[model samples]
Target: MCANKKANDDSLIVAIRDLNTHGQGVGVIENDPSGDCQGMICFVDGALPGERISGTLRERKRNYLIVTLDQVLEPSLDRIDSDCRYFPECGSCRLRHLNYPAELAVKEKHVRDLLSRNGLLGHDSPVFKQIMGMKDPLHYRGKSIFPVTSDPAGSGLLIGQYRYGSHDLVDLHDCHIQSRPALALVNRIRELASRDQVTAYDERTHDGTLRHLLIRTGFSSQEIMVVFVVNDRQADEAITSWLPLLKDTIKPLGFALQSSWINDMDTRGNRILSSKYRHLDGSQTIEEIINGVTYRISPDSFFQVNPRQAAVLFDEVIRAAELQPGERVLDLYSGVGAISLQFASAGKELVPPLEVTGVDRVKQAVMDARANAKINELVNLSFIEADATEWLKDYEDNAENQPFDIIVVDPPRKGLDPKALDVLRESGTPEIIYVSCNPATLARDLALLSDVYGIESVQPIDMFPRTTHVETVVLMSRNG
Candidate 1:
């Protein structure tokens, strides 16, 4: 294929050697006749490692180019047919085309390669355990937010995921990873919105009612919450009128419509849900029980999407912490205090119960976390509303607050900031367990913390299977 193409041709053929952080297959362009674009790295979507693929040039960066896969000249043995109808288009699940084992292998190798590149994976390093995958990876996502937009033809509403790196909606009917009830509820909302003429919010014109539809389901309680992100206040009346109809539509689906909310996201940015919320019906929050610890999830709370795997992940965090009686634990970015509640529940029987403090910047999450702690009767836990880094710096300054024996951080995808890292380094906490969703940021932060804290053990959990994303729990301890 390469020999026949003109030197100036946009078509390029390359053999994929590895997967990038975004799960895109990576290859190097070499021996090109043009020699202009030669030696430049190529990232091809839908191309698997050990496969020869031909792709059209989509974009060119300083050192690399992104190609849209046109044909797999030689498919890898690990490649498998995608089960989802919206595999490449939806852009939600990037690894659904590969077999489950092969997907896990690819993710594990990515983590190892990144850590090694960051100088954290080597001899005398932490024990790297095998990646923990799911027996049933499909429909594992307990939460889903489908973007709502108007169709190009201007006929009806289009509700689904945005295409990869684009604003185009895929008009999804079903999803392999999202909850069935959630999808159904969103579909029902689309139908009602169409009938009621509730126009989909347009970012360009900023004219419309519904912007997004967010649905969250409790795996254990089987309760579902529907939140409508709308631009106008008038949408409240239209959405509230559909409550009974929504309940009627969802009850037959064997899931309770426990909560309904309208979030006013009238801004111009790409944010999906806003801080403004108005309760429409049912409870203010839905409950999810993980390992006997109950969590009240608000509309904006940052609970794990995979509830089943969350139990396993939380168990690993608690186990890695090796909590002792009377020891204090600080949980930073503790959304809804799920992990803190688990920590308190696990150590409630100790003579001096573990003093666990949960800190989060989101007021709603902190409220939910405090309510969750009270509901679980975990007396040793306290949920504070504050920024994690600021709290850490304040703790360092005050010295009046008892120093924590263990600190667990579950920051967002960007990982810990520099100030947080500096505080952790100077805090001299005995044990620190970092729960991370992004492997690249995790490796970077771990490398920064390597001077004071040695990586004890690294466990990669498949929180989002069939996707390139992996949840990692790393145990780090103060170096001698």
Candidate 2:
């Protein structure tokens, strides 16, 4: 009822006070203390803070209102021209309108705000360090997944991201942020699918064969893995039959040199790929070296997208660890054992050898990590297939696996689990190196671990440069 009422009365001319987590401009009505509606915020998509905008409500939630900008009465100095032709519509790059320096500044401010709001920021608290940004922000992504669907007229293959807040697929000829070669591969695949009369998946009807195309590029090795997400088992045979023709077509388009191919059966939910993959051609896994450690990466591996920035991020982690020889290190959510292998490999030069163990829930990733450990010749490192929290419980019960000298965690966007933090507190680990992609979750996790840990250093790395996303690494020592 309230949502409907606000929908009728959404016209307002207000100045944007700040930006929300999604980087949308938020404006609150002036001189309305108890007023949330008349004084309620109007969230404009293209508007920036300190700018007066004339907008009407596009949507209304339970607490606030989402406004669409009709006209900007004034523009902020921070605003800039978006280079991407598909900006504000493609939903892939949100910060493209803002200059790179302004983007970095806003990100740092957001991290600080998250930390301060969660009671983790103060002069005596964690020292908010400088953010590490990319030298050249464009074309940094090594991974690009294009949704394959029919055009609005239901004619040909439309490949790109969905329109903002809608499942309407849009075609993109050039993506400035993604790798150029990866984009080229997508174009060729679309052309081939159209030529071969391959069916594009329809979300509403749930009918069709080809669903999505996933491409992973090894930044250093220049190797590429192409995965075709299909509706059923028949799509594999269909794709296999067309491979020769596709090879002939894309050979001129520069796609013949791809390293591997896989058919990912995931016609269901939005998951990247199904667990089952049918390898079709070349080596199933390609190799990429980071920090001098070689890793065998599969089609569905969770390797870092920006390999160059990843090296800098890993360097910060190594420095923050202040690792010594013979220290026992525990790596949680250690996808492919990147951190674990790096620490173990570094121990070769240390006075006392390092012992590192990595734990993750993904069985395939664990297997890959074990294989990576052997291939890298890091005998000191080991991997276990289990939830990090569950493994911690077992370690807590057994006297053999008491406390670790150091622990490194790289959790998903949801951040660290509370039970996991509790175990870490009780485990008596002296130091924890937290690699985080979401700062909001990172702040919450820091607050939970505050009882046992003190923030030693905080460094933010620009992992996704053009987008609003940023990665942070925090080093926390046991509190006395």
Candidate 3:
């Protein structure tokens, strides 16, 4: 069929072979000669593996073609009806159509494939452990951001996610993954903004005022923080009038309004928060207790969205470390020192006291990390505001800081910096724990370090369920 079909065929029948990292089904055309797409791969949206789909070619690029699913000729038995109304359009949860167990299987397979492709793991490697899935995955997100725009047909404001791969925002009434208190707070803010005639930001022409509504909730404390991302440096006249009312109005909604802040972002791009922030009302930070440690989250700090799964992920990291007394630990890209604080607390009772040092590029996060250490009364930890790559390179040269007993790196999705990886490979640390959110990047890094370090095990945690994202923790020991 692929050989017979033309580039502009009315419908192309695709038998999905596998899924890509973005949850898109991947298939290949064999001996296709219509437009030189022979042996070219194609990605189909809304198509699951082991299913025959009827789709039309939307975009035909040189490397691959994008297919829009028209009909599922054969659906998999694992497919289930999506509970959320905005299944494919919202693009928030890519695996919402599959059942929980099926989704977990797909994620695990994807991770395994990525690792195998990079030659980091064998097909039946014992080092690759079974994925740790969630028992209850609904409404696990503690943080959500609603981009503000205007309704094209009406005068009301529109607040929700932008359509997948497009700038057009889809107005959402409720979300399955977001917390109830966060959604409720969004509705109340939208109601007030609509009544006050506050303008919504237009990304097309860079017009309007309000850009985004950020709501963060503390699961254990039930405290909420409301942040208004606007386009002006100063507080908008409209926001100054109505934002104060939100402080008194949120208590009845069953969540305490811990704080409210306004972020001035006048840039033209899609960046949500800016460096400039102004505190309007209430306390500056909200607290979340995880693994007997209380973390103070600032308005601009980076914290895990799923609080419950964060504890699970942290526990797995501690178990993997197997620290000894008086051992020195280094945490790279340690935002707000969440993992560093845990290491310090774990060694608080050990003889000579284990020392932990956290390094991050963000100045505010370093500030928060120092403040958090003071808040928890843990003095054996130190925070350094420096680029992780530069810090690692510098540590290698510094005679005093060389030869750390244990090194933990929780790098960004792009994975370890190349220089950082080179330094890590030569550091000769006894133990290294890498926590990564991107499987592809993790595999790439692991392959590079395979010769110098032996990978002990890989534990995949379902941090963001119903989404294609998975958090993995790998323990590696330096080869003698």
lDDT of 1 by residue, 1-480 (tens): 223344367667777899876779998764355555566688988888899877777777666788778888899999989888887888788888899999898887777777888567773344888889988887788788889899889888999998877889999889888888888887888898888888888889999888888889998998999898889986677888998888888787788999999898989998788789988889998989999988888888888899999999989999998878899999999988889999999999988888999989988788888888888988998988999999888887786766789999998889999999999999968899999988899999999999999888988899999878888899999999
Q: In candidate 2, which residue ranges exceed 4 Å CA deviation?
A: 1-11, 30-38, 123-126, 233-238, 241-256, 264-267, 400-402
C-alpha positional error of residue 105 in candidate 1 after TM-score superposition, expressed in Å: 1.2
- Best of the candidates, lDDT: 1
Give Cα distance to truth, residue 351, candidate 1, Å. 2.3
1 versus 2: better lDDT goes to? 1
lDDT of 3 at 126: 92
Cα misplacement distance, residue 295 of candidate 1 (Å): 0.9
Cα-based lDDT for every prediction: 0.86, 0.79, 0.85
CA deviation > 4 Å runs, candidate 1: 1-11, 30-39, 123-126, 234-237, 397-402
Candidate 2 residue-wise lDDT at 298: 85
Q: Tens digit of lDDT per residue, candidate 2, span 109-203? A: 77888888866777335488888899988777777888888877767788898777787776988887887667777777777677777888776
Which pairs clash (backbone N, Cα, C closer than 3 Å) in model 2?
326-352
Considering summed lDDT, which 10 consecutive residues are worst modelled in model 1? 1-10
